[model samples]
Target chain A: MKPHTLSVLVENRPGVLSRVTGLFSRRGFNIESLAVGTCEEPGMSRITIVVIGDDAKVEQVMTQLHKLIDVIKVSDLSENERVERELALIKVNAEPGTSRAEILQIASIFRALIVDVGSKSVILEVTGDTEKIDALEKLLRQYGVKELVRTGKIGILRGSKSVPGSK
Target chain B: MKPGAKILVESLPREGTEIIFGYPGGVVLPIYDELYDSSLRHILVRHEQAAAHAADGYARASGRVGVCLATSGPGACNLVTGIATAYMDSAPIVAITGQVPTNLLGNDAFQESDITGITMPITKHNYLVKSAADISRVVQEAFYIAGTGRKGPVLIDIPKDVSTGLAEDTPLPEKVTLRGYNPTYKGHKRQIDKAVELIVHAERPLIYAGGGVIASNASAELVSLATLVGIPVTTTLMGIGCIPCDHPLNLGMLGMHGTEYANFAVMESDLLIAIGARFDDRVTGKIDTFAPHAKIVHIDIDPAEIGKNKRIDVPIVGDVKAVLQDMLSGLKKNNAYEPWLKKIKHWKQHHPLRVKDDGRLHPQYIVRALSELVKGEAVIVSEVGQNQMWTAQHFCFHHPRTWITSGGLGTMGYGFPAAMGAHFARPDVPVFDIAGDGSIQMNIQEMSTVAANKIPVKVAILNNMYLGMVRQWQELFFDRRYSFTELPPVDFVKIANAYGIDGMRVDSPDDVVPALKASLDCNGPVVMDFRIEREENVFPMVPAGAAINEMIGGHPRS
Candidate 1:
């Protein structure tokens, strides 16, 4: 099953997030990643969900999401010309020698920021599309990645067309 | 200033609620106190589950939002099954629950439960009202949500403090405006035209209607659509009574335990027009082989239901009544299906519904007797299993809302409480709960509820002294290893009498009619126990996972 990104706009109300996510688990839809935050509107929130399913199954997921009373709109951003990004923090084991310089060069090539530095370890903060993040993480694995965390992918359409109610 | 409890009480009549079924508890005493001084008629029930089922029954019978109330924790938890039943069947009900005080909500206080969290999966929508002022608006919105578009149960949980807390005395909203919850009522023009084209050309078109027809009050439109094109109609269990059982073009209930002719028609049809019915597995046995040759046109209010279980050639999302009306306007009289109708007629004549008569009382015979006495006029509610199937099979319903059963969830104890709710909704008509001995005892405590209120509901127990459906399954599939399916007989008549209700036990075939008549003649609730044949099984059965055409046990003549 291919992963499809869904940009969902919902009311900024208590328990609305659980209502949307609960539907996914109950219906047996596989969610690859999810991100949520308040939108431009005062009482609205935007949630980006990456779900794994075929076209028909994903279509059913969209329809089921619309059934929730708190959901204002659900747009499949995967189909449109869009920009996506994921923020990740990775701490790498860097000795007091060539490993440290090599890690700095790798982070510079990926245009990542060195957010924190210890005597023997350095934490790099990176923001990019999912594929770019995966590529950078793969390069740093040889230096013994110590700890890592990622904010799941969030997406938006490229043009002036915004999800209804998000503006 | 007014208390939230008073506002909650005052909101019911404004929303057209004439009656409610509820049980009192500690946290809800404030609301009950307000109810005591209010004009709303509250019927106290023995169990909270009964209160919810009764509300569901009332909703199904009257085509309005039925209301039920309960206190916190176990009380709210007890309403879960009933709420799920209504949710599965698309019955509109609003359940109000009292909660622990706001401060004690998460502190493991006495009688505290996460009811909203518990019911989130079942309810169409729910609210945990934190403020006293939100009561009126929440109540208005709850009713609106419950009664509109793919109707189902909605819950409102008010903490005890919110109910007793004071709020500004404001007027109830004249109209509810939910930006995210608008439901489409009209069908798309292009979709309607496509459906009409299919109907006009189909050689063997069948109308498969469901409870959506009843929910939309579109039984007349459904009949018109079928008659205008000379197409025959069949129904799911929830779709019973949507078309008159005696209608010449109606093929009766379809799928598992359905009529032989209906299953045959579905198997052979070229076009299947499904209205308001989800393709439940029981209705579409072995989904790949169901309606094998039919190019399906599914019309439902819920967009999610379309293509959920089966592929659709034309999917129309709108209110069933409106879609039918639009399709009718686009069509002319056509007799293209005459040959198809003749084939179905042959099937019906060759394999009519039959039951063996060995001089002992059969459940089907008792149901047929009740059908004859009611004359297609009374509301017949049924519990799950053999009793439900027999009632759906034998009862001749002339109009919609006359047949009520838990079709989706198949909750066993649904009938009696639902029958009481139906009686309250339509007091001018007779209501009967056709229950099995096993299922009736699930909520038998409601006998006291009916007796205390003096509601004249008749209970017909088909006593087989076993969990007859499971036994039939075991007998057919597992070499008759009974495996704890049998129950030690308890005197149901004595139990009925103990509740201060009239009751009788009938064993012989001749006593079936007289016992039914005697129960009908009683002024208060009466329980008539019919000692039916223990080994009787509902025939024309499609074994689970088998194709609809692969049915067994329906002999041509019995």
Candidate 2:
């Protein structure tokens, strides 16, 4: 399956996300990763979607997206030069005398920040691809990880032509 | 300035009306007089409650804001039920009320009431239009807001001053901008990837579609994906029309009233792809146990709905059509083996939906006959109770947007008025409301909405003399101690006649076709009260707080 990214511009409205997600859901599509944020314009948002399908299917979806009244533009940014980032925050137990220094060293290697330091626990914030976050989380679990929170991924296409279908 | 009794008039066409379903009384003569001369048709209802139901019907059916007009005091108060009904269903309808003159506003005035406050909780927004200039804009904004975003009803209370005051603003055409009201249409890419990876690896995939498909007009996209990936499809009751029932992959409706095969499929599936649907309790019998083995990929337009019901493995938030398109782009057609499909097909044939045979007239029989008679082509609206469940069970919906019902709110007295609204939305197709006696009585006054509007909506009332769903429960759990479930019935034929509507009460199976045809043939509204046995029950009910498959059959009670 070819990985495709679509940059969609849409009107910023209440329940808009629900409406969009509802569209995918009703059609039984599995959305791999999605992110939404305010665009350069006011009252508008850029939704970066990464999906896996053939070129023809992606183009078909783009056409339908173009038809939506609120949808300003939809472009498959997969070929576009783009930057992607994912953030994950994980907490791990640091026993009084056992490998606390080693944990901090591991965090340092990953450029992760130790955001919280309690006598029994240490919370680290990590930013990377999904695999990097998953590996770090898994490695930290050996020390009795207490809690974890990861924001759903977000993405942006490289350069500034704006998404093709975004209004 | 004319006398305080000036007969104010407002003419309108049927293109874009917000609200107009209510009864006008003594002091509302001026507004009613204006209505009489106007092309804007007015529905004079037996009760104000029916007016709101009619408006809600219109809103849900049309996807446009519905308009219902009523007069002051008791008339306005009666509209409260319909307003609340629309509010619960999140239907976009604007109710206009004719108030006593400005001078009589706060005098504890005869036939005067504070309708704005009464309808406040039941509306997304409400306005008391004071000046005539504000009338058109207010009406326009009410529609704009009501039809946009979440799609809910808004109320406008027009005082006599505004209705009669000679303000020269056109009755239509204006732009209203709201600062904090933008809805997002595009979905995020990263989330799409996470969802796709899960779907690719999933051995058992289930796609659950909700009413939002029809709302977004994403039925075609849904069908494409379902067919593309060979995913099995189950639907929330409101999600009925999203996919045609005849599709090979369809699992029928899912919920408390859903078919056994559908519930079983949902339970056994390995991956659940929930679209547009908010997993209501009725749909997910026991949330913890529902799709216990499946990884849920929840793609919804609403973010709040994601973690509210069932936890998700992949959450895709965007419009269903666009998201489906994106998801389809990611597909490699790995669904070669149809394990889930084969199993569900086996279940469908093995445990087909059946009615009890005791030489008694059953509501299921009526629904089945109706489904066959209509060829699953007509728009079907059902009131809540056994009738709603039976209709869901028996009706084979062939097209998307054809089956309209009050699913989320489960509002009774919803069928007839909604059928009227459906008829108005799809004028060429015939619309039918399969209602239970108790449910029908809740908004029976809409008989006038049908008669006055000359909408030929066929009404099939399953007159069982009891609230069927609740009674079935009583028999199942409470040992047949039927309490207030039994109702003193009214002669629907006489009631139909009083409202200038035609009706037939059928007790025998032979009369079913004739009654259905008669109702269909009548130019105006027609009611066929099927005097079905009072003890009939809708089967395959999920026991309270149990798993979906742990259903308690509707066994007869002594």
Candidate 3:
């Protein structure tokens, strides 16, 4: 199944997240990644979700999302020209000498920040599109990665277009 | 200024509610106290489940939003089945549940429950009121949401403290505006034109109407469209009364336990116009082969239901009445379907719905007798299973809203309380609850509520000493290993008398009509127990997952 990004705006209310996620689970729709936060408008939240399905299945997902009372708008951004990014923090083991130097150089090449430097490990904070983050993580795997955390993909329309219901 | 409880009590009348079916508990005392002085009449049901079913019954019968109330935790939980029943059937209802004090909400307070979370899946929408000030707006919104779009139950959970707290005495809002919930009322013009094009050229078009027709009050439009186009009509259980059973073009109920002729018509039709009915599994057995030769035109208010089960050639998403009216305006009178009509007539004449006569009482005879006695004008409600199928198959319904049953959820204990609710909605009309022995015992406690109110609801129990439907299935599919389908005999007449209501038992076939007449003539609630054939099976059955044309019995030629 291809991953399709959907940007949804909903009324900021208690249990709204559960309602959306609950619908996905019950309807057996697969969700690849999801991120939720307040949008530009007050009393509204934007949920960016990466869903895996074919065209017909994705159409059904959009239609079902529209049925939820709290959801304000749903737009599929996969086909539109958009700017997308995901942030990931990777903590890796760093030896004292040459290995430490190599890790620092790799971080610099990827433009990742050395957020925390400990005696045995360093936490590298990376922000980029999903593929870029994946590439950096792949190279750092040789350095003995300790841990990794990611904020799932978030997107916005490029140029003058803004997601509807967000003023 | 006004207390939340008073505002809540006052809001009902403002929303045009004259009565509510409810059971009170500790958490709801403040609201009940306010209700004591209010003009709204409250019927105290014996159980919370009965309260919800009765409210649902009221909504279906009157075409209004029925209301029910219960305490938190167990009380709210008990209303789950009834709420799901209404949800599945798309009946409009507002359930008011009392929650524990806001401070104790999540601490597992003695009677606290996360009711809003529990009902989120079944309800159209729900609210857990956090402030006393939100009560008025929540009530107004709940009613509006429940009664609009694809109507279903909406619940409001008010904490006990919120009920006692004071808020500004604002007047009720004149209009409700929900940004995410505007329903499409008019069908897309292009789609309507396409549907008309298909209807115009179709040689064998069949109209498959369902609950949406009754919900939208579109029976007249449906009849007019069918008559003008000269298309034969068949109905789902919920669509039984949309076209009079005796109408020249009516083909009776379709699906499992449906008529043989109706199934035959569906198999041969070239165009299937589905109005306001979802393609439920029971209605569309073996979906791949259902109406195999027909191009489907599905019209429904809920967009989610349009392509949910069956693919549609012309999808018209709008209110049924509005869409039918649009189609009616674009159509011309056509009587070119004489060949198709003749074929259907042959099927109807050859394979009529029939039951064996062993010189013993049959449930079908009792239902037919009741229909004749009432002259097809009674408000007939039914419990689920064999009794429900028998009533739907045999009884002649000439008008909408006259036949109410638990079609979607198939809750067994639905009818008795629902019949009481129907009685309250239209006291002038004769109301009957045709029930099975096993199903009637589920909510038989409601007898006290009916007897106390002196409602003249007539109950006909087709006692077979078994869960007849399950037994039939076991006999057909399980090699006759009855298991627990057999139920111990209970004297229902004695139980009715214990509750201080008139009771009678009829064992002879000749006494069916006279017994029904006596029940109808009674001034108060009466229960008539008919000892029917214990092994009687409902015929013209379509085995689950089989095509509609694959029948087990009731084929005259076979």
Candidate 4:
């Protein structure tokens, strides 16, 4: 089974999200990762959802999503020329003198920014592909990471031609 | 300038809403007051559940948006199952509910329930009208959404204050545009061509038609396409009357309770041209093995159903009638299926739908007798399960919208209320609810509505004294451990008499015909209770999860 990433355009209406998600649950579909944001089109939102299932089932989910009234359009953005980004924040248990310098040096090499400083911890913010962020978090874990957070995958279609909505 | 209540009341005739099935209570008192003065008709049902079913039945029978209303809390909650039933079956219905006053909302005031929240999963779309001025537009949109695109139920929740308020506009908008909701009415030309290419080449093509054929009024086109292509046609339960039962190519129902010949035809066919039918589990049985040899061409207005259950070789997503018309217009007339027809005829001759009629009284016999008396001109609604199966097998249905049943949801007690709905839609036609003892009792209170409204519907109860369908399953699969399937003996005729309707009990096979005749001869609603064989089971059943071809009980040819 391959994972299919669906880029869905929908009306920004109350309960539309619930309806879409509710449909998935009722139909016994699993959602791996999802991210939603206002798109280039006014009053419309773009939702990128990653679903892992057999080709037939994934296709069924896409077709069912199309039936929802608020859903404007749905496109599989997986193989399309598209850029995806995920943001991560990691707080490491680094003491001021003993490990702060080493942590800052390692973070800089990965182009991650040291967003916060404290006597007992260092907060590093990383914005990159999911794989890159995963690698940075793995390295940060060796120094006793306090906490880590990630905004799931958000992507857009490539080229100048827009994903049609109310532009 | 009218209050929102009056506007909502006035909106009925504007949309051609003739009658409403509803129950009144506190929050909707204003709306009820308005209804009292308006010329629009209302039939107060015993429960909100019946109201939704009646409305759904009305929609199915008349091809119009049926309307129903209820007050808040339990009233709206009762409509839940009915709405879900309609939703699953794609019945066009608009359900209105009165919410608590705007100021008291979320405070959990008396008789207040989050009805909009409760019905979100069931309705195609819903509205919570907080403003009085928005009443007209909301009504318009609700009707529009409910009656279009894979039509299903829609809900409108109006707070008491909105109905009572009196702020106004000059005129309701002539048009309302939903930027997101545009239904694809025309099939894609390329897809249609691909289907035609597949159809022209396949030797054993079968037309699998469903409720969508009736919903789209495409029986004419369906018949034309089947005849032109020289393919045999098999109908789903909801598609029974798409072609006359006696038609040469008609192969009865397909799936679990389907005819043996029909199931065999499906299994052996190389090409499956599915028109407006979803491949439900009942039809497919073991999904992996279902139509294993067939190349599928599915045409449905609902894009969701095109490849939802089974894989599709050619998917034309549009109205069934429109797409069928396109296919008919484009295809060259070719009768290339003589071999296929001969093979099917051989199977039909060998595995005809028959039962051991060692009849004291049999439900199938009664159904056949009733059909013969009516001559395929009556409207037949059935309660779900064995009775439904029997009617699907034996009833001589000849027209669209004549056979109505809750096929998708399989909701018991849907028959009588739905018959009431169908009666209202076609007052001149004879309506019969062929029900099982178990299913009829589910909403027998509707007898009150029937009697009061003087709806000339006949309730033919096959009194098996048990939940026969479930019992049959238990007997076959679970070693005869019948648990909770046996129903207590209740005299349905006496109950009907108590409801102020004439009724009779038929105990012998000889009485079945006379009982049916007497019931039909009555002026108003009549219940004919036939004490059918207690242990009889629906035959040609493909046991659950078994392949469609592996059905259990049709005798081989002599």
lDDT of each: 0.93, 0.76, 0.93, 0.89
Give the chain A TM-score for each candidate.
0.95, 0.85, 0.95, 0.92
Highest DockQ: give the candidate number. Answer: 1
For candidate 1, the per-residue lDDT at B417 reads 98
lDDT of 1 at B48: 93
Question: What local lDDT does model 4 show for residue B33?
Answer: 98
Worst 10 residues of 3 chain A by lDDT: A158-167
B1-558 per-residue lDDT for model 1 (tens digits): 788899899988988999999988999999999999898999999999999999999999999999999999999999999999999998999999999999998898899999999999999999999989999999999999999999999999999999999999667667888878989899999999999999988999999999899999999999988988899999999999888999999999999998988998899899999999999999999999999999999999999999999999999999999999999999999877889999999899898999668898889999999899989878999999999999899888998998999999999999999999999888988899999999999999999999999989999999999999999999999999999989889799999999999999999999989999988888899999889999999888999999987889875532
User: What TM-score does chain A of model 1 get?
Assistant: 0.95
Candidate 2 C-alpha lDDT tens digits along B1-558? 321222223322323752366677765666676666566656666677777777777666667767777778888887887777776656778777778777787788888888876665566667766676666666667777677645677777777766667656454554566443445566789888888888777777888998777766788999888888888888888788778888988888887877788888888888898988887888888888999998888887655456666778888767878888898899877655477677778888777788666667787878888778778678888898888888888888988768777776678887887787777777888889999999888878778767877879888999988988889889988999998999887799999989898889899877877788777777778888899988877777888788888876732311
Better of 3 and 4 by DockQ: 3
DockQ of 1: 0.60
For residue B403, what is the lDDT in candidate 1? 93
lDDT of model 3 at residue B371? 84
Superposition error at B43 for model 4 (Å): 0.9
lDDT of 3 at B60: 94
In angstroms, the error of model 4 at B533 is: 0.5
Question: What is the descending DockQ order?
Answer: 1, 3, 4, 2
Off by over 4 Å in 2: A1-167, B1-15, B25-37, B99-114, B166-175, B356-359, B497-500, B554-558
Query: Which scores better on DockQ, 2 or 4?
Result: 4
